[model samples]
Target chain A: MTESAAAPSGPGSTAASPEVRRNPVSTHPIASLLIGLLLLASIFFALYVPLYGRLTPKVGAWPFFYFYLLAFMPVMAVVLWVVTLLQRRFDTEAGGPR
Target chain B: MSHVNSTVFTIVVAVFILVTGIGFAASRWRRTQDMMHLNEWGLAGRGFGTFITWFLLGGDLYTAYTFIAVPALVYGSGSIGFYAVAYTIVAYPIAFIFLPRLWSVSHVHNYVTPADFIRGRYGSRGLALSAAVTGILATMPYIALQLVGIQAVLTVMGVGADTTNTYLKDVPLFVAFVVLAIYTYLSGLRAPAAIAFVKDTIIYVFVIVAVFYIPAKIGGWSHIFGAAQTHFTSTNPATGKPFGTFLPTTKKVGSTQLDFVTLALGSALALFMYPHVITGTLAARRRGAIKRNMSLLPAYSVVLALIALFGYMAVADPATVASVKKTGNAQLSVPYLFQNHFPSWFTGVAFSGIIIGALVPAAIMSIGAANLFTRNIFKEFFKPDATPRLETRVSQWASLVVKLGALYFAVELPKTFSINLQLLGGVWILQTFPMLVGGLYTRWFHRFALIPGWLAGMAYGTLAAYNTSSPTASHWASSSDIVFGFSLYIGISAFILNLAISVVLTLVLRAFKVPEGPDETLPRHFTVEATDTPAKERASVTAGEARPAPGV
Candidate 1:
């Protein structure tokens, strides 16, 4: 079953070349890199508690930690939107039909 | 059981009947000639637009467990429970990176389940079976948690007889479960997608109203926070430590900052790994729909942030606190708060919202687990020649069995056990990340290596979780444990071990010139759009491909 299924794709060795060309993120390298870094930074901001986990700076009733986490949601939405836009550029550059 | 509020009970029953009607009628929605295939039954025909996709994905991801459990956590602990908020926030960006690729690949290949994708990618039925088992295992506790949410609401409504017999006591829950099971069997994913509209509307209306009205009714947000801070800071006599910190503390003893960070990261990573979430993602019509929904879904998280504040509201209300304390179940915190603060009709609305919320996700989750069973297990092992009609029948029955198993867990086990098991579910599901997500970008990790890595992670996670105990319970007391004198989420720790082991073993396996499995997918397949009808594609594949090909 597996062998016949593998037959159409020829062999595993020949499969590598097309995979390299079609790598999604490699099409727009700089934009993908920036998007990757933005994703990391967003995660870092949310998780690095030492940076914002404090009570002194309170937004209304929210502590700094709570406010920071809640605020990051919108920021993340925007970051992800930008990433989507960048990926769209990559998609166009690669001449992939949407 | 003791005193049923006639108005609230009547309203809840009315709304529930309406929801059940919608659930059954959803089969006619987006009417298709063939509802026998996995795509129609499991993925709602894979043509959901942005609007329905948003509601379905939102409804699927944020279960009644989130509604009941997040606040319950905040009511019991303090700021650390806001890890849910942080997790949902970060989950989007992470999902944005991979979910579209997954959707595109699954669409192009007509893959019904993640395990199907894993099998095709790795050419290892054993690896795919492992993924299927983990998905089903993780989802059982999750479905159980939804029932726990419903049970909490029913207990608060005083619906069942206060008998010594457990069966009589849970008659209402049984009735609710039967309705959900029947509708799901009839309508499959469409039931949840159709009903998600009503569910999200009721939730958004009630939550928005409660956030505004409840705060004003209980002095203000400032007062709620003050009450919470005071309550959490006070010492518990049993533990001789502070109840919890109002803010996450840097100290080592309780609710440590590291625990908060790790829990958030671990949950974010685990959220998309759940088969149910992927089921929702794959139901969408296009990759762009998924990407758009990823950005838009955070709107639900904003609502979740406000919902978490209900814990603070409960803390502020002395009546709510006294009622929850009387029941000795912190899960009832939000319900008690609602019943105390809102009018009878509004209480009914909120309760119906929560009950229906549980129903929607529970249905979707069962479908997800059932798809895994039918596609990766039953079809893979038992009946390779199964027809699409047979496959759908098997999945429908598998969903019912999965739900019943979850019902048994919810009814028999202690409530805390189900909640802790849900945490353990997150841990168990994270073990699959390397195989599922790693296989997406690169097939470098050998499938053989991934199996052992997953086993090591699962074994280490279970043992670590078992070893950790608290004053209230022993064995699987919490999802966080002390690692090298710092508290960390057990999932992240286990994941680190899983990844490291897989990487090391992959190097070793390569050195030995092991036969890497045949790769059936091309890189272009991951970005493929739905140019032709899915049925046409499936037919073409069936005509061209070998009979034993894993994905349809």
Candidate 2:
């Protein structure tokens, strides 16, 4: 890391290079992909079961739309955690990948 | 004006004064030798790391628009309004993929706005100016919408009780804006950056408590859910349509599961494209902070999801619904609900929470608009050798003027109409997708082709949105219009048109010898490792904060 008063600092590294580095690999991927699939199911139920003309019995005291949406949050979060892990290829260094 | 109790008003004023003092002092926060440069004024010296970035970006993102408008839409529309929730859920994964790359490239080039990237990438100031103009124009009304959010709180708080005159009704709002304008003018980005800490804390406390306490008071979760379901299923007397669907459907009404998914996807793609979010991201010290913040941001989204449910709570309570109907102001549903249910002190806390919620993002939006004006408009066309101090000065004044203009929008425009205009804003903002986000992954679209494509999209979106009307108001009331048999949000349809034109024109232009601009940015610039590059490398970066008084 030579100092050049006129050399450009590449975008992000000028800040902290903290001691506890983030692992490039996340906890899970296949699970994350599967979760995304499950989420589509949940979101569909949220939409179809409530909005569709004469669907099925509602989820709880809760209607399908309300029930599925609240339930979808945790599932969505899990899937995002997974997608993020899979997409770790993008957040890597300027020279790391094309 | 009972809700604006004299005691609370005094306290709010004193706190605002104290906060303003702290804000003006923030010019010196994390002190550097000089404070006149645009970097210091606009990006807060660009030295923020993760912790501060979280609060700052959080402040910039979850705005008064989300707090007031989302709940109102939910209250009025029944179920379709929750698209905001889904859009928010998807925004993170969407941002996680590209934001870090943007951070790297913008940092490397010292680009101040998204337009800066366009200008550098394609060597076209016209294209850059188009993007900048689009961002600023869309954002002005947005800032105004935040003002309307504050005014709704004020109107509910009884701050405007004495006056039928519009000017008098907005007195409290006017005072807040004046103070906000001054602090933002003096402190620049630091004003919002510091105030975000206070705003987020107030919001988290009041919202968490309200989410719990309100449900119990309304006869628990079961009763709340039951009431909402019953209400949505009932056919409206006016339209004979059930209020709205709480969920998506396979059956197409121009609106379907596909519409839901596409709107979510389109908005998720467009979220960070707004110049303000980029300004917030670039101010951070490293790329990792942006990545880390994406996961952490859902913590706020959880709060937002609860906030949306406030709409359901409003729907379930018959008295609250009766009151909203009497006033014909659904925007006051949350404010009225709090007033009726919560104790005075807690209501004040909640009141301050929503008011400050509007304040934080209002500051950021104005600053983002000002940056566009200074960088793309002022610098590009005016004195190319404009001093950093001059640019900063012009931006400061521009921010004050923008807020004042938005203030007029809030006070002067009818509430129902302003909301429709906000939908109009959603339409105009989506037009920029081709240049800002599309160009990130590929440059296959020629810049020449892209410009006309952008214009076509803007015209179609504006006209389609303008023509959209319902029984409630003449022009801007309805969000859905049938397009080719499917009910859809106008923004998505318009964006598809924009992309189609750009793609077709790109192939056509390539057939001739329309030269593509030099690519100063390489593929790696989009994926730079944070720790791998040292601050020492930046020593030669000519874009470093130039001296204030001299010719920059």
* Best model number under lDDT: 1
> Model 2 off-target regions past 4 Å?
A1-61, A74-98, B1-15, B531-552
Model 2 lDDT, full chain set: 0.75
- Model 1 chain B scores worst on lDDT over the 10 consecutive residues at B543-552
By summed lDDT, the worst window of 10 consecutive residues in model 2 chain B runs over B543-552
Shift of residue B23 alpha carbon in model 2, Å: 2.4
Per-residue lDDT, model 1, residue A79, is 82
**DockQ for all models:** 0.41, 0.21
* Residue B509 miss distance in model 1 (angstroms): 1.0
Judge candidate 1 at residue B246 and give its lDDT. Answer: 88
Alpha carbon lDDT of residue A68, candidate 2? 52
Query: What does candidate 1 score on TM?
Result: 0.94
- What tens-digit string does per-residue lDDT give for candidate 2 at B1-552? 654676455545655666677677877787666667677778887789889999999888899878889898889876666777777777776677678878877777667788877876666778899999989888888888888898888777778887789887778889888988988998889988998888889889988999889988989888886777788778899898888655566677734676666666666667787878888998887777787788778777777778888999999998789889988888899988988898877787778878888888888889889999998999899877887779889899989889988888888877766677767776777788788777676767788988998899889888887787777657665666669887787788888899999999989998895877654554445655554443334523434322111100
Can you give the lDDT of residue B8 in candidate 2?
50
* Candidate 2 CAPRI grade: incorrect
The TM-scores of chain A alone, one per candidate, are 0.73, 0.39
Residue B503 CA error for candidate 1 (Å)?
1.2
